[model samples]
Target: MPFWLSWAVWSAPVKKLGARPAISSGCSGVTMLNWLTAQHLVGLPGMPTTVQGVNARAKREGWEAQLRLGRGGGQEYSFAVLPKETQTALLMREVAQQEPAPAQQLQQPGAAQVVNSPKRDAYTESRLNDDQRSVMAARMVLIREIERMSKVVSQQRAIDTLVGLARTGSLSPYLAERAERANDRKNADRALSERTLKRWLADYRKHGEIALAPARRKPNMSVPVWAADFLKHYQRPQKPSAQAAYLAFQREYPGAPSLHAVQRFLAKLSPQAREMGRMGPREAKALLPYNKRLTDHMWPNDVWVADGHKFDAEVINPNSGQIFRPEVTSIIDWATRRIVGFAINVAESTLATLDALHSGISRVGMFRVFYVDNGSGFANDTIREVVERLGGEMTHSLPYNSQARGVIERAHRTIMVRLAKDFDSYIGADMDGEAGNKVHRISRADLKKGSQPRHIPTLNEFYERLAIALDEYNHSPHRGLTKIRDSETGRFRHPSPMEAWRRAEAEGFAALQPSTELSMLLVRPQDLRRTHRGLVRTNGANYFLQDLVPLHGDQVRVAWDYRDASKVAVFTLDGDLIGQAILDGNASDAMPRIVKDQDRRVSGQLAKLVQKGKTLTGKDVELRVIERPAEDDRFQQHLLEAEKFVALAHEPEADALEAPDNEMTRYDRWQQLDSRQRLGEALSDDEARWHASYPNHPDFKSIQRMYDHFEAEQARA
Candidate 1:
């Protein structure tokens, strides 16, 4: 008999023994599923596909029969009264016949699309520790020996023989060793028992050798309040040690954890939690989830990002002979990771940014959008005007957020930082401190000593080297560009920037070209200026031409080439082209004669109106000088006044009233006597007396020490 038929036959008699009485599901009418003909369930599992076979099985199984209520009424069996296996098969078949939800759909057992999930037991080996794996391996060894011996005798007899041999220590060396190791762990008998061997056989049959791996207990994860407090101190910006934090916690709480306990508690924290407070905001951002910008849909010239970087290596200025790092302004295409244009300047400035834009736009046409940072070099009205004139939009990244411009920042490191390492004057952050200092000292010392430093390359040399490096970078494989298969190598690899650009070009991508007028308009700096007569004053210089005379007093826009400041391109306020104006440094007057004449005429007209109001004048007056009496007459009056006055006066006797002089006489006498003594002449009595008493003065010792010091120095020299 077929397997399906045999299963139906064996299960029919048992199902019929406990058949329940028919029961209704209590609906208003019978559902089509409640009463199914044998033919309706014929093709299901464990049921014969033929109607007659299914009916015969139903009769043998005592399935309750019902009459169909609708058209084509006939005897049908109650689906709810069928055997359990038959009902299960019908449910599975019905489910398979219906449409499935996309996410939860599963393929049938024998279907072409069936895919089996990996079993949990497949990774059992990985979950076991070394000791557990060793024990499992030993047990597997003994099980294999028993299986091999079972082929030669009855299964029980084989098992008994193996147990006897293991107990007597008379089995083969490998078998005996495995038996001893399998029983080596806690609470095991000295030798393998019959029951233990049977249990091992059953486990091997069910879950394979993984079932024999020793069980392991999970670690305790509960945190005490004291440990939590210690963690607060340990996880700080200062990053205190476990012991130090423990000490701090002990100061606040007498029940603080021990140092070792703190360490163990810290070990249980997640990696991200362990870094809390210990890392800066920027550094800690590495643990955060970031938004990834997708550039797969972008074309080569769709977006360009511009940034300025100060080169790490010092280069000598060709004009000034001074060593300094130059700032490089670079514009990169977001799609291909290619540097379309770049400019090098002594420092970051708006001019450098404009030059870089000109270089890029002139080569590859205008980009759709200009992405840049808020640096002064790129955030000015001039840059905005240049971008707008080229039919592109300019956007600025958030302040202090370099991550938003990570592409260009990374490019700086890859291109400029790598190039710096090739030069001897590299002073990057990662350069050896001693070597960097030595390079700095040498360059400065050489300049101070009036000699050029040979170690520092000139600006021109640096520019040439940078050009070569950029070219190499564009042609070399870049990891940031999309990966593609090489035709020649027949292997998958990342495409170079140039290769990616060429691929884009091959796919019919073309750049938007700027018109000649627009090109010229965007390449120079422009401003609004009002003309005086035929002259327009801008940038501290006056520009003049014959064509500007008619529009002298009108406001106009003027664009001047930085490289050629002698002339400026003039246009009307409405953007109509006027004639070019040349610089007029030799214009004689600060104001033109026409403007001055107009001013004079306006002054005369105002004066005429004011003259009509008043015409009054006043007469002049004369004055005379006062004189005093002559000198003889004045002297005669003074003598008469002295004769009229009378007074009594007394003077002290000069020699007796005079006391000995102190400060001034001592110094003067000392100087005079000292000079005389040095000349080998005799001193006067008054000088001798003063000089003799001067040594007893309170300031003499300090003055003598100072004199001794001065004399010693003079003598030594």
Candidate 2:
């Protein structure tokens, strides 16, 4: 047979080579001619002489490429893809014959014994899947020829070629041209276009061809002062028409530039004009062509993904005086399709993601893989340690590649849709504290008026309710599960997650890793700090124990600074708010500062309104106030009334304070008070305290807080 004929016969889909080819191993003395030819055919650093030799090399070097069973086992495909160098190596050694080192090869015509091109690094065999590499190689040739002619082509010809290539289904003409330059001529055989060719040269001129790594365009661009001003002033909605921008520009600069001149300026803003596009934080565009690890075969438990998303809800933020969005985090078991843990909060960021992960690991033991999107919060090594310590692999998806985490992404969608549709009711409401429960209750008429947009108390309230809603979801059954009974034990195979989890405890599934840091979270800051002799801090302010400077050097994280600020909180970085540092400031007068003066003036109006209400006795305002460490006269009076209430719930005196037929007198009182006060009038301490504190339940904390406030007011007076 002709050498080419024999080669054709040898090249037919040779099953004997197996699915995962082993072209990158072994150096057992090949004959000079075979070695040189192999080098030329594969151009790879390590090419085996025979099939057995290849397998032996692969086994010895563990370079066997992974082969995966395709969907429905339709085909066997390579799982392990390699870098470009390896692919080049494979083409040179396996596809081409070396023949003799050209007559031009002798000692590089007398240069120091030619280095032989570094012997093509041992990993030179093709790294891309075989089929893809062949296609890519063929495509490269087309790109080279296309670009070769494009540089000299006219503008109109370039445009026609660009359109032609797109019409012909070329994978990014720019990229094809790039691949052509990197690979040998034989590989550059794809269809070509003048537009693509010109673009390649233009890019080479601006950003060297090598810099155009197979990646997406970056989104970050430093906006020029003029552009920033343009964005702010550009009146026409999105991507303004040229005529509109030119007109607007003429108006802004008035004779500074004409429409024709501005249009010329705009022509400079064309996609090909700028070396880099406009900046949009660029975080999302940095990943292009995708990383091998990102696109590589990902099995469940290979990574754990974490992220926080805002859930639309009926929420009111009392502080901001407006409804704000609430956020929630979910830890999903990628393989089992289970939501392992969740945490909800007002802000969805790094700290919140940490809190959610904190809740997850504490509840579900540990996961093997942690995956999250490339958001600021999920990008921290501090947060990543949670996974690392748990022996879990951590990874962030390429920006916008939510599909990479198909399992959890689907779960997020499933839960969000289900919750939005079947959302029951918020668990609790401020109807129980701030203004006396005057929160407009959804009446029968309001309920009947479908989607009337009833008011929500606050973002905090919404989060609490979402927490409950998510819990219900975890306990819900799925159609995918099958009920099975063990042949011997007769236990059902599929149980609700909660039920299965409970049973797992009985079967030794609960083994807590007693890391000191993890265990410390159980201790509250109030008790733990005194025990540990540690100082405390909260909200960026630090507190030192009266006699505890000995421990000042030690650091801790502050957790719960109580609503009253009575005790400062401190914690270790690992989420353990285990101790408190009590405040021991003087009992004397405080020197008011400029900021405090402004604060007092700002609060003066709220005070005047609170005092406008009818003077109700402490008994009339039912509120829970935290017991102050030290006794105050007002606190004592309120404490006595609360004690009497608990003692007199069934007593006739309690009924005397109630409205006729058990109507809430306090609610009616608030309505009367609000009617008398203008929307923004100032009120006295007694009134302002009640005004702000009434919406929360009238518990001891609210009342004692009021009493403490009145005590401070009296002292100030």
Candidate 3:
């Protein structure tokens, strides 16, 4: 063969002389090589250790000859025509001489390297099975011992000595142990043969340490016919166990294979295919590949994503004083990954979403685009209108695709979920079931008896904690944000969300600042109410103002703070601001009134109304005073005499009144009567009158608290 022809055959698979081939172990190390001079095969087993002797063997074997390409122009024999042992020895020497490139030179941040690269390290070792690693280690030991011996004696003589020691069981302890490990069956106690030791050295030299690993047979990937029936039972949304599915399959197909065989077939299925029917579309997305969202070009306030999360811990509702999980609506900036604003409400609603959005605008000004999922809270007209009014467009992601809003979804876990764990009342999915149940029972019991549990935070306290968490979050370093060089240290690190926002602001980024009046109009919830005369009626209350007079007898939209409905911001049907309206019934209801003032005003009005009623009834005449006459003794005597003829009937004894075991205070007496009335027990006439008067006592509140504590202690006992 020509030298170029031999080189083509040899280098085609490896691509380079020093590179390892991609073929399986059994087919490796069998490539044709370019022609070499007879002098290069001087030390092989079959060829004599002299140029003349190598030439004699080559001539006898009829090896093809080619002209030498470089240096001295002389005859060269084709490497393919050499005996098998000589050929193996030549390839092993060539493999052992190659050097590996350093890993640091090839490894770059976020870059992936090929698995078969010569720079094998711990990462490559992790991919091998324990058995393969053990065998590779043993082969390395043998190769090292050969290299060590070669320094003292000739390389061929060292190999002959080691083979003699192995056959006689006189090798060193470590080498004896390694010889057994190199066997196909690890515990066979088989001594290393001369051929086997040479092959081990050859493989290790070719592919680095990884080449020493024993070859693994390919698994039987062919699926049996019964696999389909087994899979039918296994791949269900209920996610039955393999054992359960096998039993079901056995019932349907009695001739099916054993469970282990079915399992082997299942193991061969790709992960995505195995879960085909075992999960819902939303859940199954976890196994599917996802495209990353790039925010490199986005700026602070460019896009804001909103989502609602139910707080995992229970808190006392401010209005009702009842234990419940508060819903937290979070608005996050996409570029900086900051939680700009959040609001806690009783539940998820459009109003809560709007409140959260308004808060974000107030903090960082209006965002350019409002991005959110297709939830009722974010996909409503009110939220849309608010975003539009703030000079932004509202867009909803595809339904059931919450992954698109990953920033906000991750925030819920990172911020609120972590915040919940700090509280003893946390009932998150990760909380222990017994501990959570105990908390629930204790909290409900205390609340039922009109007491607040210390573990359950009040709404205000929770708001304070949430605020602190958000501030810390905004100031902490975020991995998603771009890294910046620290001015003092001159090292690069991820910038905090707030730091990123400030930097962007310094780079001429300004959020849209809405006017105070417009912000108030946009954030307050709106409702349509009809204006009759000068009053706008809704929520069982009438709102009136002089400005509404022109819009009388027409329907208009009304906006008011949900926290306070006493004052409202009025608007026309065209969304034009009219004027503010006060609650028609009593604006004073919005404020506390002094007891003396209320009493004096009420008494005066009653007197005036009585006088007017008398006049209307025509009974307003005044009588003149006359002198008193002597008492009418005759009528008085007759009354006394008629009393003698009146008959008296016997009265039934009144039921004895039940009393408490201990002496009762005034409040206690009141509670006793109250409990009796609640339980359908009739009170004596005197007791009933006393009970009605007790509520007006000056110590009613303090005394009732004491009595309640006493009752609770008794109940617990």
Candidate 4:
């Protein structure tokens, strides 16, 4: 089914003190400007933040602003305030100008600032007295103690335990409650069911228990009554201290209370420090540090980066008639200023991304650093090892900060708009054959063919065509290079992208993939899982060819979407195609070897469907032979159908019309086929008309698309 899409909005709040206002986000800079101005109007003492701060915060949280239900039943839109700092994003929009507001009350020089509202001060003073403050501090200690029970949770008992222990510390019940509320809100927002959430909570809270009130009965431990009573009292307000315990004993006609009594009471508790993944930086504290360190892209292999954007593949594959969707990947040689290597794949993912790096390295040597966006694709180890093995570093563009890796960012657009515009039509549509019979198409009989074709090309035929296309792309001379070579000179002036790679190789540049013509495919990193041996496993099977075991559990990077068998095939890092390990398990996925079996299935399916269609026409056409689909089935059905109709009046065939046609008409005959094949197949009427319009027409993608459109319209009626 075709997926539906829509637009949404973002917004943020602004604060003002003096003439300076809080930076705003969402609809306009006015919100930011108004916020900043408002802050100035309030004459606040804190340092005034620039538009940059507002944008960063907005982007971090999702543009602050308004959310509203949109037009459709499923449509929920959020109109967020643009990060006030995103100049280009905001300036592009046409929002109303800011209205005049009050003048500023700038801060006085060298003065201490009390950054709090009078209302805030009064409320705090009234709500929390000296005793409450002391209790609050103790409460913090108790909470920490409860948290120590380990599977940490901020429950009341946990709070009381920590409060009882700390004596006094950074304990704020308000903040604690807020944090808990936020956690609950997040889960709520996630839309998980209550029972599921409770299950998760129970699992998380496995450490110690929390109680809403104090224990009714004290534990019957073998300790002195006076000492135990002292311990319990100390946890409560106005409870007895060590001195008071001794005084009480004396008053009751007793004498000896040892120092060991107090020491033993305090020694009952111990704490554990937090654990971490990498000893270097905690995930919470992990961030791009700003130390004013300047990077000039000064050295080779400094950074290998990646990013994603919607490419106008339509324009890129202009002549193509197949349903086209392509997201390209390109790696750049930072030091030499060249687009070292690239690949055009179906989606933005790590699976289809690894090959691009291999291409760059194989072509240019090794880039120092690999830079990429903070996306799941690059998060995999495939990218990490590729960069490290090349003796390069891997860095990432800050989230929403494209300027960090500006070089390759522009390179992608340059190739798409400047170099690739010529191939768009044929990339998605059938470009080769004269608009008819020889054209790649989906026929009515394809309904019974089974799977949706990735590109509708036989592997044997595609491998040949792919080689030619690669050669054409690599050798092309154009503006991206300093030298634009023509047929007249047939010479090199400045180096093109490919030529530059060749030059770099001469100077000791090493690439991952040595032979670009090996005919490879890209798979998203998601399909793969890392095994203990470091080999990448996918398709519910292990990839253990001898060449792969060395890297064992390492992920195999790909440069294209190979999810569909037609466009997808696995290869070794050493660059061997059509090879795999024998496996023993419940791996249900059919291997490419099953290609023959699948073909036979398609052929049998097509012959059966043709028979069914003939039944609709009320004729018993002689069944000549059932052909396998992979070999070629489109033309066979048309031939069979046409011949079957001819037999409708013939002597022996005339008796075949006795089969009932009240229900299964030739059109409904398509309903018997599988969805994938039906998607490519044309309706019987269109198929008949197409044959009449151009008996020898070859390409079928366009004709099938038209028939699908008509079928949809008929459905509406």
**C-alpha lDDT score of every prediction, in listed order:** 0.69, 0.43, 0.69, 0.39
What tens digits encode model 3's per-residue C-alpha lDDT throughout 46-153?
789899888786565445454555566665765545666665566444433423322222111121111123233444456568888898888888888889999999
Let me know the TM-score candidate 3 reaches against the reference structure.
0.56
- Candidate with maximal lDDT: 3
Alpha carbon deviation, residue 84, candidate 2 (Å)? 24
Clashes per model (N, Cα, C within 3 A) = 0, 75, 0, 119
The regions of model 3 sitting more than 4 angstroms off are 1-214, 289-294, 318-323, 421-425, 430-456, 482-494, 585-717
- What is candidate 2's lDDT per residue for 610-694, written digit by digit as tens? 5543254323333333646543343454444443323321111211232112113454555555665666666665555444444
Segments in model 4 whose C-alpha atoms lie over 4 Å from true places: 1-305, 308-324, 343-345, 380-382, 417-495, 498-538, 542-580, 583-717
- Ordered by TM-score, highest first, the candidates read 3, 1, 2, 4
RMSD of each: 32.6, 24.2, 23.2, 31.6
Which prediction has the highest TM-score against the true structure? Answer: 3
Candidate 4: worst-modelled 10 consecutive residues by lDDT: 3-12
Model 2 residue 100 distance off true place after TM-score fit, in angstroms: 39
**Total colliding residue pairs, candidate 1:** 0
Q: Which of 2 and 3 is the better model by TM-score?
A: 3
Q: Please, what are the lDDT tens digits per residue for candidate 1 over residues 416-521?
A: 9999999999988899999888888888998777566757876656765786677677778988877899886799999998789989999998877675467767
